[model samples]
Target: MSRALLTALLLFQILAAAATDTTSTRQPDLIKKGWNLGPIPVVAFDSDLGFEYGAVINFFNYGNGSTYPEYRHSIFMEASRYTKGSGQYRIIYDSKFVLEGIRIMADLQYLPTLAAEFYGFNGSESRYNKQWIRPGNKDYHSELFYKMNKDILRAGLDLQGHFENPKFGWIAGTSFQRYNVGPLKMNKLNAEPSPYDESDVLYNKYVKWGIIKEWEKRGGAHITLKGALIYDTRDNEPNPMRGTWADALIYYVSPNLNEKGKGHAKLALSIRKYFTIVPNDLSFAFRAMTQNTIAGTCPFYMLSQIVTVSPRRSFFEGLGGAYSLRGIMRNRVVADGFALANAEFRYKFWRLHLLRQNFYCAITAFGDVGLITQKTKLDLAKVPISEYNSYFSNTAQRPHYSVGIGGKLVMNQNFVISGDIGKALDNQDGNMGVYIGVNFLF
Candidate 1:
């Protein structure tokens, strides 16, 4: 045999082996929905006849001059039936407890088969500490801690479903919620005049509903719409910290302080396009969105829930982690009404498998920007920490920007773990992007 012919044959053999190795050792976890396929007893074991359990722990601590030390800890448990049918029963429980800083919650979700894969009944009780953002020892903290405990109970149902065809597919879901919000009770005024010393005080109760839908295809186009109607009955402050003493300052100065949470309806829509503009080596994607609050009101302190309020606004609304803006704080953007557009570029390379399995890697680059169109009156003049509020003052005036790079580690075809580091261009702090999570950012 000629030397050239031998070399060609060797290359062909390597490619064949690579393909065969991947196909033979593959596991059934890659299959989305199916019964065991190989042997009877073994297939039963590989099928959905077993219970599944998962847990995640997340903790974040700020080092630079935060009011006080704060930490967030949450635990989640999921239990599901072992049968394969249109309906399976599942239950999920989550608890987030903030000992010193607020945000105490317990949530339970009951998912019945046949409804929708992602639909469920969820109920939760949340107790928010009176003064969440303050600088002091637990004992020295403001009177807000003594005034009242902000309590809320929520019950709701969710629906999610998908449809598929040869060239296109779509998914949709909606939810309905009712809330009972109340204040804490206490006996005497106490020698120290704690906010918790009050009694029989009630805030309000209300209902809310929302609908969300999105559709996409094997081609490269998609559309989405989401809207909500809410009757709010909570209080707000200009700062993240809420307490009776904090409120005293506002009531003493701006006697017109708005402590009531109003009701409102909000709607948003977006359309996006994806194109393999550079063959398999490169691709491009873009999205545009518009949002408005047609009716209702929001408490000043609850501002972050209604809009994206962050040091960076451009790409703050999407999933946070290694994906999205690679290197920014989670949900760091805030605004009442805004519009946004995003562009992403991706490149892939093969032939490199670190684990000798079906493992592979790739890199990506992306940018996102957004502008706020409207908002309610924003004032931090009377705030004790006016400087922190300044960063958000003209937030509606600037178009936020970020740039970053990311990488992926894919195992089999369905399991992927990725990370990305990004930095803000105009960032004075010049921090590095940090993210770690599963699956793609998109």
Candidate 2:
């Protein structure tokens, strides 16, 4: 079926199921041994990346009531395209008890981004010009002038054990990533009234100034080996009500940050806690994380992202998107070492038994903050400060703050359709962000 038809069908299914739903006060029995299928349309938009449209189909096997919420085996397959050419084609497999004593997870994905956002270095020290992104403005360069284009292919396997302990475990994983990048492809974007060479845009200035390099400007590949120690006690992995999840992840990269660079390493730490405020209804959740490059050099193309427990969205990167500081501009905070924290209140307002499945609706209020703890190596003095100030950025650099509210529709406590609206504390972070995505941020 065509994407449009599939999306319409997905909406019909949800609406038809809800219309036929029965209100329920009593808890339903845990899922009986059986197979279940769920398929949903994936839709989202970024002003720079255009609208994202796709579908994710999930298949699950639940063996008895032994682990109702936790499945015996799960498979997820997705093939989606974006209007802007930034999208994903992926497949993932996960199992808790299919193996004798361990949990196994594997994923293969190809993500191509047409207009990847790229502002200059130094976090808030890098000026943000609203006019650059606002087409038709007299000062407008190109709507995508501040963006870039890239293609990435990633594949990995992960294993975690110590099931008997439940709260503590050791995990190991390995992955290979390939990236192809360059200045934004504006001819494809139709951002200019007349065709222009990339030489005219300002990202070329970063290249000329040595902020970005010449060799890896086209992108490269690397193999990453990672091992981690974890402490997890959450009751449910999807949307936990209580318990703590803490982990320290370390990475060793071969062929280094770029194809020709020397091997280096990075480290990250995270702790998340969930609290039950009222039975079956309200709860509080919080997470804190720190990430840094410890040994060797990393390419500018790869330094912005840190470790994350939850899966990331296709078109976003770094600290200020829906997956991070919701109301702030995406990638607003990228540095050598960074710190981030998030707090949220989740309230489940209604429940129903629909289409032979359980469904619930919820609302959330949240706050997020991030800071650049260490600066990326740069000769700031050589780069004239007055030129950067020509943009609207205020000189003072501080923690980025944002507050937001969101809504969710969850089915069988696993699949979630989420929408959030957030406001930034700084106008430079952009006025606000509206995002539609999957899963809880933690």
Candidate 3:
């Protein structure tokens, strides 16, 4: 089907659902729930990733509404690809009854990209050269020079157990991933017909200059034991208007790949809270996060990773892009560790309630900021001043900032389609970013 037809069908289905209500009260309609399903037509774009096309299905089981907003089980699945040869296949399952007091959750993902982002490291510690990546500039290299290709297969499973207080829990999970990384190939992304100049590729240049280690140039295995102390008391898990959710996970990465005794420990923490400004019509929400490699060496390719709590449009890494510093170039501020904060003012202008299904449209104004808390180890003294002047910035370290607005189409207080436009505070970070994706950032 055409994009317009698919979108129209989704809207029609939502409206048809809302028009069947027999009463003005939302309670009666929600009380008779057994299973609720929502279909999402994914239409979004990012400058780095290109346009995306796909769909998502959210399955929710309410089981008689004893807990109005909470579901007994939820399953989410999505498949999408960008026009530039990047794609993702994902499936997630969450359930409270899967194992006694423990909630069982699993995330399976397969992602492939022809043009993954690499903007150097450590926020402003190293300068970003716009001319190098921006084609047609006097100092321009190939358009694909700054990008690399990576294929990843990853799966994670967590068994969360709660004690007497439902608000507190202990989480233990394991993640296994294998990565294959290489220089981007112009032939694969429909560039076979017309090849570009490939004499001086960025990835090879870095390797030849000793800037990128030989071992990390080609990706390898990363397996970690994940443990956390989590506290959550959100009034609504999907679109919280009140309460707080705090979590911290420690990852003990086991020695893998060709390197032994290279295992390390990493710490990640996120705290989010929401407050009602005008009941359900208006509210404020915010999230603050930090991550660090406390000991041992982290792979060069993995240095940019940010803790993932939910899905977003592009890959999750370091501090940049939509989920972290909106409007900043994807992976622009990568480092060993970083800190970030995001705040939003949300307003609901429309509500649709019909029969057992309901929907709402919400708009939000937001601000985001992030910076490298720990620098990625790099020695500039050995490198010549000319190289630093050509490829790196000579500026003081500072935070990346952005301000933006977004709106969401929410189904039954659960499935959400969100779009936002953001502008970076400095031109070095990026001029702006436009994104469409799933769920809240936290």
lDDT (0-100) at residue 111 of candidate 3? 89
CA lDDT, every model vs. true structure: 0.31, 0.74, 0.75
lDDT of 1 by residue, 209-306 (tens): 11110110000111112222212111111111111110000000111122322344455555444556554335555545555555553332222222
Candidate 1: regions farther than 4 A off: 1-172, 176-262, 278-281, 299-324, 351-359, 379-396, 411-413, 428-430
Clashing pairs in 3: 21-355, 127-393, 304-318
Global CA lDDT of candidate 2, please?
0.74
Instruction: Point out where model 2 deviates above 4 Å.
Output: 1-24, 29-32, 46-48, 194-199, 256-260, 309-316, 380-388, 391-396
User: Which scores better on TM-score, 1 or 3?
Assistant: 3
> Model 3 TM-score?
0.90
Give the winner by lDDT: 1 or 3.
3
Candidate 2's residue-wise lDDT over 93-132, tens digit each?
Answer: 8886767777888889898888776776657878788876
Quote each prediction's TM-score: 0.43, 0.90, 0.90
Error of 3 at 329 (Å): 1.3
TM-score of 1: 0.43
